[model samples]
Target: MNNKSLKRWTFLDTINAALLIVVVLFMLDFQNNATVSWILLAVFAFWIVTVILRNIFITRVMKDPNHPMHPQPGEKNNAKD
Candidate 1:
């Protein structure tokens, strides 16, 4: 993958790490369990959205010329076409 795409993937990884930390800290803090549950739910939802969007973006990037993930012409992907 190009440097730009690699950077984006790294950024997404950072976000995922931050979310995991937040959830871990929240679980460790025992007070306000209800609020913590809601916050964790939101965090999980945001993570899911980011992953889905990232996949869509990567798929688009793979279609661009010169992208490392782009399939070569006349080469078949694993998926049946």
Candidate 2:
């Protein structure tokens, strides 16, 4: 795709990845208490949903063969910008 759309999607992927990492870290931390675990679990579930949606969006975008533009061979595949 074009650089504009590519950059927007890349930013979204980075955001989603960050959220996923944060949730995982919170879940794994030994200092987390019971209530904290529950709250983090709730937010983790929501973030998981968003992560799945983000994955679907990226998958759909990749499957779209009629992409108006594509990156050059030596450029980054996921982050064109």
Candidate 3:
């Protein structure tokens, strides 16, 4: 991957990690509460779905020829142009 893509992934991963920590803290603070457990479960599910969507977006940006990540002239054509 190029430097730009690497940076993007790193930034996203940091954000995701921070969010996970917040969720874990909430879980700890509200231990044994049935309502809190259900809320946490829904939040966790939403987080998973968002991560999957982010991966799909990153893959498309890297692979789509029309994207700025596309190779320059005379360079290797990894994309299915």
Q: Can you write out model 2's per-residue Cα lDDT over 1-81, one digit (the tens) per residue?
A: 346334434556677678768767756553747777777677768866866686666566656656544445565666324
lDDT of 3 by residue, 41-61 (tens): 677778778766766776777
Off by over 4 Å in 3: 1-32, 69-81
TM-score computed on alpha carbons, candidate 3: 0.49
**Alpha-carbon runs more than 4 Å astray in model 1:** 1-3, 6-8, 11-32, 64-81
> Each prediction's Cα lDDT score?
0.62, 0.61, 0.63
- TM-score, cand. 1 vs. native: 0.46
- The prediction achieving the highest TM-score against the true structure is 3
- Estimated TM-score for each candidate: 0.46, 0.43, 0.49
lDDT of 1 by residue, 1-81 (tens): 224222234655777778788777756454657776777778777877886686776667666867666656665553211
Task: Give per-candidate clash totals.
Answer: 0, 0, 0
Clashing pairs in 1: none
lDDT of 3: 0.63
